[model samples]
Every structure is written in structure tokens, then in C-alpha cells.
Target: MGKIIISENVTLDGVVEDPTGDEGSVSWFTRIGDADRAAWAEVEHEEAVGAAALLMGRRTHAYFLHRGWASRTDEWADRLRALPKYVVSSSAVADAGWGEATVLAGDVVKEVAKLKEEVTGEIVVYGSGKLVPALLEHDLADELRLMIYPFVVGTGARLFPETSAVKPARLIGARPVGTALALLTYELVHP
Candidate 1:
């Protein structure tokens, strides 16, 4: 079965919402120093090559489709545009115009499990704030690749919700990049 990996950019305080200022707040972009840019480049390259397919939530999909991954020639755009995309959403109506895009409307766990069985490479989830907690609840995520930024957003959507159970994860690797960012990889331990 393929591994389900979550590659997310989070703040020091664990906020994951609208860091690029495309969704709501512009604070994250402004606070991102030169060091943060270098860290982001490393994280992006790692995720781009590691993932075989991209799994996203509705909001994230919409945001990225409009802003980041829309152009075919953008950096990391080819990988994103070429990879098969699975979007979990109840309200997203339009298909992602690049590659094979499918809407997973059934039980998230069941659908993801089926995908894992069929796919060959790593099934990656990026910035799927709403879907991350659900996947975690179902024990669907195998790995977590987090790029921890320096600044702390006092209030915003978080990567992990409070309702989630405390699950222990083994640290697989850590790389300090730029000045204040750390690329941390963790493997989820099933109990």
C-alpha cells in the first residue's frame, strides 16, 4: 500500500491558515524573512519529488488552483500539474483542470484506504487544514513533514485540532534550514 504523507507549513504556534496571504491574513507573508524563503525552497523541493499524487481539501484546492499551481511553468508547477489529484470536499464543484482530478465524496478514510491500495508512490497531502485532523483521526496519515516557520500567528486555523487524540509519532529526521525554520519529518506509530 502507498503511504499517506502530510506536508504542511506551520507557524511556531502551529497555525497553518493563509500563510501566503491568499486566503485571509497577510501577516504571515510579511513576517516571512529571507531565512524563511530559503527554508521554504528546501521543503518545497523535498515534497515535490517525494509525492506521487496530491491529496487536498476543498479550500486548499481552490486556493492553490487559483494562486499557486495554476500555471504549468511555475516552479514546482509541473510536478503538481502532472500528478493525479484527489480532492476531498462536499462543495467543490469544478474539477482541477490539470491532470486527473477526482472528488472523494465518500467516507474519507475508506476512500483514502482504497487510494493507498491502488497507488504506487507516496500519496501526499499539502495544506489541507480541514482534512488533516480527519485523516489523523482515522489513522490514515503515515508520515508528517512539517516546515515550522519562525513567527507565531496569534490566531488562525491550526494544523492539528484540539479534538484530536494524542498520538505518538517517531521522529524520522530533522533539518535546520535558513535561520528559523526546521524541516521535521515524523513517522506515525500505530498502536
Candidate 2:
């Protein structure tokens, strides 16, 4: 069975929203130096290469599509372009411009449970802020890989919101990737 991994770029305060500052919100993504960004990128690339598939919410998918990730020829973009993608959205995707994607619009828990059984390796979730809490609540997420930036965005969408149920996890790995980033890996401990 595939492990559903929540891979998120987070601030020290646990905010997951507007990491790139594209939304005109507080962002720590661009504050890091070039070397730090490069290191972070390397870690992300490695994760992308190792993942079996990419999973995202509708808005996250749209965000990437809007950024034109589909047309980029870089290695990272190539990896993303070739990976199998799944989108969880109630509405029909007008265009999966990134590539072919399986849309799960039914019961979130049931659809994800079915997906977990169908694949092997890691099904990595990125920037699915709205979908993550549900995944955690349903115990659908098997692991969490957080790329933590040094600073904090005082108020924003968080990977784990205050309203979410407490989900226990044991840290499996923690390492400083560069001057300003830390890579923390944890495995969900189901009761």
C-alpha cells in the first residue's frame, strides 16, 4: 500500500499559507538566501523523485497550473510533469492542464482509503491546506515531511489547525538542510 505523505513548506509558527508571498501575505520562502534555497530545493527534488505520485486539493492544483509548472523544462518540472497526480475536489476539473489526474470527489475518507490500497510507495501531498486536516482526522495521512523555514508568519493557514483533532506522531528524522531550513520527518502513530 502507498503511504500518504503530507509534504509541506511551513513557517516556524506552523503557518502553511503564502510561503512564496505570492498572495501578498507574509512569506518566509523568499527571505532565505540563495544557498539555503538551493539546499531546500535539492531536498524537495529528491522527495519529488522518490514519490510515487503527487496529490493535491483543487486549489493547490490550480495554483501550480497558474504558475505554468506544466510548461517548464527544468528537471524538477519534468519530474512533476511525469508523475501521476490526483486531485481531491468536489467540482469537475475544467482542465487538468498539468497532465492527466484522477479526481476524487466522493467521500474524502473512502476515496483516499481506496487510493492507499491501490498504489505502492509514497503518495506525496503538497500545499493542500484545506484537505490536510480532513486527511489527518481520518487517519489517512501516514507520514509528514515538513520543510520548516526559520521565520514565522504570525497568522495564516496552518498545516495542522487549532480545530483539528490531536494526531500523534513520532519524529523519525530531523536535519538542518541549509542555513535557514530544517527538514523534519515524522510517522503517524495510529491508535
- TM-score for each of the candidates: 0.90, 0.95
Regions more than 4 Å wrong, model 2: 94-97, 163-165
**After aligning candidate 1 to the native by TM-score, how far in Å is the CA of 108 from where it should be?**
1.0
lDDT tens digits, residue span 1-191, model 2: 99999999998889999887899898678899999989988998899899999888999998988888878788998898888888999987645457788899998899999999998999999999888988898889999999988886798877886644578999999999988789999999887
Tell me how many clashing residue pairs each candidate has.
0, 0
Residue range 107-175, candidate 1, lDDT tens digits:
888989999898888999988888999889888899999888778779888888875578789999998
By lDDT, who's the top model here? 2
State residue 172's C-alpha deviation in candidate 1, in Å: 0.8
Model 1 alpha-carbon drift over 4 Å, by segment: 91-93
Give the least accurate 10-residue stretch of model 2, judged by summed lDDT: 92-101
- Cα-based lDDT at residue 181, candidate 2: 87
RMSD after Cα superposition, model 1: 2.0
